[model samples]
Target: MHPASAWLANESAHIEDEADEHDLHAFQAIRRMDEILVNNFMVFQDVVEEGCYDLVVGDEAWDVDYFLHENPELKRFAFAWMTDFVGWVPMPDGGEHEVALTADYNAEMIEQRARYGRVRDRSIFVGSPEDVVDLPFGPGLPGIREWTEANFDFAGYVTGFVPPTQQEREQVRRRLGYGEDDLLCVVTVGGSGVGGPLLHRVLDAVPAARRLVPGLRFLVVTGPRIDPAGLPRRRGVSYRGYLPELYRQLAACDLAVVQGGLTTCMELAAADRPFLYVPLRHHFEQNVHVRHRLERYGAGRCVDYEEACDPDALAVAMAKELHREEHAIPVETDGAQRAGEMLAELI
Candidate 1:
């Protein structure tokens, strides 16, 4: 990782623990964003000048968009995997937190637009049109343009890798030392330590789950932020830290229990795997945006974190969902190609 990224990561490592303080974190991050950008602006400008790039592409990099807004000489293409730009996240507690963050974002965008100009020439929504709708606050606002229903024709969810074929699935299973009759359950909580509580709850349900279904094995994937050593060992349960190309492993599993992150849920949906997703409490993006899109695709069982806390209930849920029929709507896999063509037009 770059020095700046490492510094930022170290600074924000505790944010996940204080879920209710998300708004405060957002405000502070936004306040610091300009300072960070200003510090690196000259270096970035020097690099861009030397490169003479026809178009600058950014993935949820608002700072890049702001820079492009100031320097309209180069075309800008911005894409986002989430609906953060829409600024209409419905939080569990209410809209106060959402409103505060949205106001901050809007203020920044409006100020930049007045001082410079529109931040982007065109933007791509890496999701279905249903994911982007006019909420009470409205659609993409304040200097964000060319992103509406029309973008959906070319925009699609990019899963980064194709789902494995049946033969390949078997290859992965055999490589993992699983027999044909052994039922494999892969549990993950994305990259953040916020899911640590969820992982522990799932572990608590393991004994009951194995009793409900014998021959069932659990593979708890503690992502980069969580240490596998922290979780207690149990029979029929194994712990591993951060498997690369984890989507392939997900494809080969009989069932998956995951946190409500778009990328992980979408990967399981794309692989046609049975899964139960527990969205974090008070998380607007996961509870609102990701849930809407997942429901649209008829993918994954939405389990509340409170409900998942009950080991018996979670165990029963896990047993019921294991080896169930795959009925999720197919996810588009050509998004990268489509996005590439869209950018090619700008060039």
Candidate 2:
């Protein structure tokens, strides 16, 4: 069980990621997603309505109704997009059932297939172009405009996440002690109520990893809920406390190691960097989505956490990937810009 499970009753929470030492899962991702919606929507409810924002995007349910209710014109323009899966929905009225997506996983289009058979569903939710962007990573958000051009009038936007500013990057960079030559290996060490076992596995093999790259350097960032002391110390590895200098670091790094978190993955894709993803154990859905990109799409490799325990095994995997002659993953350079355009068009 996740530590935050105890705090589930409370409207607010700050749970620690104790999965590795204690029996807890890191529910921080969901919590953060919820927090973002509640806080952002609450603060800008009036602005959103007055400005006539076209769409509001989010990953969880919090102030979704407030956003919808506040804007009368937006009732038709607004959409609730789920970036994860389209399989199910948990209604506020106590019901559950299979649901269909509005778009294909990678298609830049939206089409409704069906409704929740028995659930008393409210609020329009879709994982298709009409609602959510199908790409697992956020870099695909820009494509929503293309879909909007054909489907609906996409106006200004509301999203659960935001891009970092240049000033934020410099501050994070200084704190992480990043040098020009050092390769910043940004990672989301704990996720969705789980400590990243793959991270620990990779850190344990850092010495061997260094041997593989000879001069590889890294800046591994873990969530604040995780203790810095718990992470293994190494000559080339530096642990950072939050997702600082995230964009700059991602852009600076030659490669990345991460969980299949959509937020982190999208940022990396936006940075146009190759990545090595290790989906959390038991997260079958996440594993499938990440594997689809890493293996099927040839973006990167999805190595099992267990295999990372052995230095030689990890070294070999690293060697194989680092040595690959294929070009790095191609990320759209104008995702944010395109997203902005979509927002402009919608408004």
Number of the predicted model whose TM-score against the real structure is largest: 1
Candidate 2, residue 70: the lDDT equals 37
Whole-model lDDT per candidate: 0.72, 0.49
lDDT of 1 by residue, 85-187 (tens): 3443445454566567665665565555466544454567786566554454323353223334532243678888888899999999999989789999999
RMSD of each: 4.3, 9.8
lDDT of candidate 2 at residue 266, scale 0 to 100: 54
Please provide, for model 2 over 1-347, each residue's C-alpha lDDT reduced to its tens digit, 9 standing for 90 to 100. 42333323333233332234212222323324455456655454545545665565543543554344333344444444333333211112222211122122223122221222111112222122332433332233334335333433322222223444556555555666765455555555543335546667777767887887777777777675566677778887878766644566675566777766555665565444567666555343455443543333346667666665677787677657665566544433443454455444444
lDDT of 1 at 9: 28
In candidate 1, which residue pairs get closer than 3 Å at backbone N, Cα or C atoms, i.e. clash?
none
Per-prediction tally of clashes: 0, 11
Q: Which runs of model 2 end up more than 4 angstroms from their true locations? A: 1-85, 88-186, 190-193, 294-297, 341-347
Best by lDDT: 1
TM-score of model 1 (CA atoms): 0.81
